[model samples]
Target: MSLSARLEHHLQASGLPFEILTHRYAATALENALMAHVPGDHLAKSVLIHKEDGPMLAVLPANHQLDLSRLQSMIHHPIGLAPESELEDLFDDCSPGAAPPVGAAYDLDTIVDNSLSGLDKVWFEAGDHRTLIEMKGRDFDKLMQDAEHGSICVH
Candidate 1:
């Protein structure tokens, strides 16, 4: 699928302009960036973390790694990466490793890295390995206005 039904609904409802770019099959965030000809720092990748309350989505640049210690301290809860088995249930509409960063669309809490702020634009997976959604930085900010923001990644 080009996009998750939930994500498509959310995107349209936001009234924000977004472009869907297709690329060769990619298995990882970095691969997605390279295949799409987008800078790794400008491609947002989402990691699902198992938290005390429930699952949380952490968004950061494709080139960075999630700082678990920093994230736990910020959220005040112990967290671990959700296993591959759990992803399908949480993101039933997405490909095995391609989870979109818009947690709100999936009914989950999200925390975005501050590093993405002030960027000119950003790209992210669109529920599949071969399609990417692109949007302006300001539009991204507006879309994620309700999500928490902090430093949660390391090079």
Candidate 2:
């Protein structure tokens, strides 16, 4: 199944209202925001981190950069970026660089940057290079309820 398909299933099962925005293929989260004509700050990007114990997802706005020091402090362990090969194997249903920020879809722990807390709406990859999933901020919060929230990024 493709990323969009899996997302659709998950959203439908959860009964959340959302819209799927399609755009030209993009290889990066910032490019996806540009192609979708959404504010970069409202586009959430997922960065997979490999810790000694396992993997976790770090989600932040497309315009922000992950604050590794802050994350390391919060996680209390050193974390490194997961290689593309690892992502490919872990997110087999999605494109190489298009995994959704909602890590629950792939059964991984998730941590979201507090910077995204107040956006009225948020956009993120739909598991492919050409699709975006848009949802209300409340819905985003609900979707990520199980994920930890912290100051994990720097503007």
Candidate 3:
């Protein structure tokens, strides 16, 4: 099955209500803002980071960037963006620039920005740039229990 199909199955199995949004091309935050007619902050950004110890996934509001230093402290390791070429090996069944927020396929821990707590629901890549998945913040939290919650603000 395709990666998006697997992700759909996973969501169904988890009993989470979600909506899938598709775009003509890469559905980046900028594209999503235009498509959904919402500000960039409403879109969630999922980034894959590699640390000296291991790999981790960070989910933050599109309006903010990940604070590597803070993330390193939170995960207790020196963390940096995973090399673009290594994304496939890092996330099975997912291609480069198409990682999901759940991070289940990567078998890596995830950290979510505390700012997400204010949003009732958020949107994230559904294993592909052309697709997106929207779910409640609480549901997202439940699905990614290994995810750490913190202030990922760059300031």
Clashes of each: 0, 0, 0
Query: Which is the winner by lDDT between candidate 1 and candidate 2?
Result: 1
Better of 1 and 2 by TM-score: 1
Please write out the lDDT profile of model 3 over residues 61-103, one tens digit for every residue. Answer: 7667788888777767777888876666765565456767676
TM-score of each: 0.98, 0.95, 0.83
Regions of candidate 2 where Cα sits further than 4 Å from its true position: none
lDDT of 1 by residue, 1-155 (tens): 98998999999999999999999999999999999999999999999999889899999999999999999999999899999887789999998889999999999999999998788999999999999999999999898889999999998
Off by over 4 Å in 1: none
Q: Cα RMSD (Å) per model?
A: 0.6, 1.3, 2.5
Which parts of model 3 have CA positions greater than 4 angstroms off? Answer: 1-6
Q: Which ten residues in a row have the lowest lDDT in candidate 3?
A: 1-10
Deviation in Å, model 1, residue 5 alpha carbon = 0.7
